[model samples]
Target: MKKALAVAVAVALTATACGSEEKDDAPQFAERGTFTYAIPADPGELDPANAVLGATNTVLAFAYDTLVHSDADGKIVSGLAEKWQAQADKVTFTLRKGVTCADKSPVTPQTVADSMNYLSDPKNKATLLGVLIPAGMSATADEAAGTVTLATKDPNPFLLESMTAVYVVCGEGLKDRSVLKTKTSGSGPYPLFESVANDHYVFKAREDYAWGADGAKYEPSMPAVVDLKVVKDESTAANMITTGGLNGAQFTGADRKRVEAVPGIRKGSAPDGIGEFFFHQGEGRAAADPAVRKALVQSLDLNELRTIASGGNGEAATHLTSLAPDPCRGDSVTGNLPQSDPAAAATALDGAGWQAGTDGARAKDGKPLKLRIAYQTSAGPGVQAGMEYVAQKWKALGVETELVGSADAKYSDSLFKNGDWDMAWVPLGLSLPTQLVGYLSGPGPDAQGSNFAHIANTTYDDLAAAAAKQVGAAGCGQWTNAEAALVKNVDVVPVVRPTQLVASKGAMVEVIGGVVRPTSIRMLKN
Candidate 1:
């Protein structure tokens, strides 16, 4: 029952828009105005299951349609699945008929089943499938019945929510995964018309596509073209927004005030569901000690951190999961956080038999307390500032922190996987709760491959499993328990929850919704 309630709340938050009282009055764009958007990074892949990076996820969000989708309010809504049901451990979805893929092939239960099967296949390099689809589960289609049956190993309460991540792809066009590097074929409303690597991408709406809500605020207004430009620099992106070079673009902390101050520049923020510093716990003298980790946690001033990290654009996060404005609803263990007292931090070091050295850095047995902290240069300006802030704070606490910045495209994956640094920064999206599996489970990187922390605990794993099986209120306790255990054990430190900012030209293009989703963007002609 509690599980059911939790699921309901989660669905409600994802499907309904927060603070959306006024009806959207933005005029629809002309049938052929090309809406150019600026994105910081280029998408790594067009394939939904293989693209784990945030930029890639952004592209996939626009290119594909899942069985279920969430609205601005975080409530669950129908996508490809018109209706669904669960009985015991089996869940079935009634596919929406008459939907066609980019190849003009009709969307059927078989297409969904085939796509899911490809994802579930261990041989496939699809990382997201392992987390979204449970092991031993198989998808089967019945054309006559117009339904797809999913058989799970356990009473998977989050099956429908999980299906929201498995995008339906055309079985015919997807002969090789490499083709995703250049082409896309899905049952989404938008079609990839053309793509220029690292520069621009264009999507044209499908006239025959019709699977959105009955009264969706914004549909495909510009049916002819939706263009995306890759602008690496925030200043350039902002300039594009102001000069009418682009209709919309995401902004970071440094550009927040500037963009908000621009006349007729509208802004929107969503709880991005990621706020944590990845502690490289595998090796190194300082990081290898649990007491050192606890002291670092105690020494962090969250309010100050929030100000520096977010440039006053975000609030300090007290828990691992985001707060009420988030799509995924779960209680955070903010109270259980180690006390933010520098004196206590010093005492913790003292208790661990570490004494201050001549240089004001902590040392135990003549070894200095020092560790290398890494941050990806491509994570945008905000993250780079946050890393520097953390370094300064740790230095005050008698810890020597070496800041290492990487410019490599896959720097994060390499850093975490190779245990190359003492700490790193990462972002986790809230679209699916099952994303926690890799961090907690000990199978060494299964599917969805990013268990870089290599963190594992039997008790926490059990709790996570139990939580996964619950849907509503019952699941909350389990989720809370798991979170508490993770935090208490210092599995990951909670940082400031950063809001995703999109800078748009208010005069030329009015943003209809509060938080503009990838699929919900529609330019309004002034």
Candidate 2:
């Protein structure tokens, strides 16, 4: 039974959005069923608007609804919004009628407007704000028109595409942000039915679900329940696949090849996304000097790192926006990264006034040129090897590097607290240049801006602002130029786009853009 409810008051929102992939023609099954998969670790948190990890996105996508989505080819498509139209400074979205939350609460158009407001409020501190919505944007609901209009202070050409990543939450969860930490209140085809701490997670399909991405349609074929488990050991996950105990797993390295050896196993992959080291310049840090930043970047052999990290399955990255669904495509990074030249790097450092000691350590005012570099151990062996390789190469250049913590422990800490590391090889993979705007063009450390690398460039800012005025494909060229400007200046380094190879065991499971769309997975023929 669906409740008939309406918000008498029109919702005025601050502004937030994201992009998504659509699955339209989902397969139907003869009988209700269940599906299970395994993972190496638990995705940290489930909140869509708050969490920063992509792991959270990989799992929660099964239970959330974004306003708009992108097709595999990167074209914008309808999601929760039936359709949208853009004008000079605003984009109007017409919500789908009768969509309901997991708690059976009716998700009115007001719910979406409310969601936008919830994420927009500064006190709420939604991590995705600027990445999805332009700074100083707002939203208004036109009840009579059955639409919610979002307007930015300036223009945002990628507004529609950005919405693909901003999942909508109903009023209940929006009202109390804490509730979302332990529970889910979503409007997608499945709800997070149960989660066994560090062990497994389960979701049951919503029988009356209506708004699924293009690959997922509401019908008889939807899996009755989705079961997910965490199998830490790769061998254990592969064994489960062999026995058909689990339908799929996010495989990597040799495990992917092993899964291919299994007759029934299905392999799926998306561009592994891109990776790069962040040379942080927190107050007085060694890398606080751009010459050190440039010298360090130029010192390492990025080509070799790409080879090790991608396991020879990928090529050097040309764009930071490598997500398959990214609407903009261009080569802004080629020939732009600092070339690996030890002599030139040493010369640059020498010119920067770092006197080389007899021990081969560069020092200024008696402090050796020693710095800590942080990397996440959670990244596969290939990435771990790449980080080590980088450290060794930097050491050989006489720039002392202390390979410190796992980013899992220090990512948030480094960003929010008294930063502990001077250099970090943290690479973020995003589909839109808009997403990169915050990290690439914001104010430096004192303001605590999202520019993790402490980059502040008015030129790039102006270029981005100009790109925002034109919508969609028309503005991609300008956005690329803006990003290229950043790359050219070394404000941010764009690295290689790697492949995310996932090996599946069942023939029934359909994979798109390298992921198993839960709603599209049907039972294998007996």
TM-score for each prediction? 0.85, 0.84
What tens digits encode model 1's per-residue C-alpha lDDT throughout 255-360?
Answer: 6677778776666655544556656555444655678778888888866766666666666665454422233455465676687898999899988978987778
lDDT of 2 by residue, 373-397 (tens): 7766656678778878888887877
Q: Candidate 2 vs. truth: CA RMSD?
A: 7.0
| Model 2 poorest 10 in a row by lDDT | 1-10
Each model's lDDT comes to 0.63, 0.68
- For candidate 1, the 10 contiguous residues with the lowest summed lDDT are 8-17
Total backbone collisions for each predicted model = 27, 22
**In model 2, which runs have C-alpha deviations exceeding 4 angstroms?**
1-31, 39-47, 101-106, 133-137, 171-181, 232-235, 282-292, 355-359, 364-367, 507-516
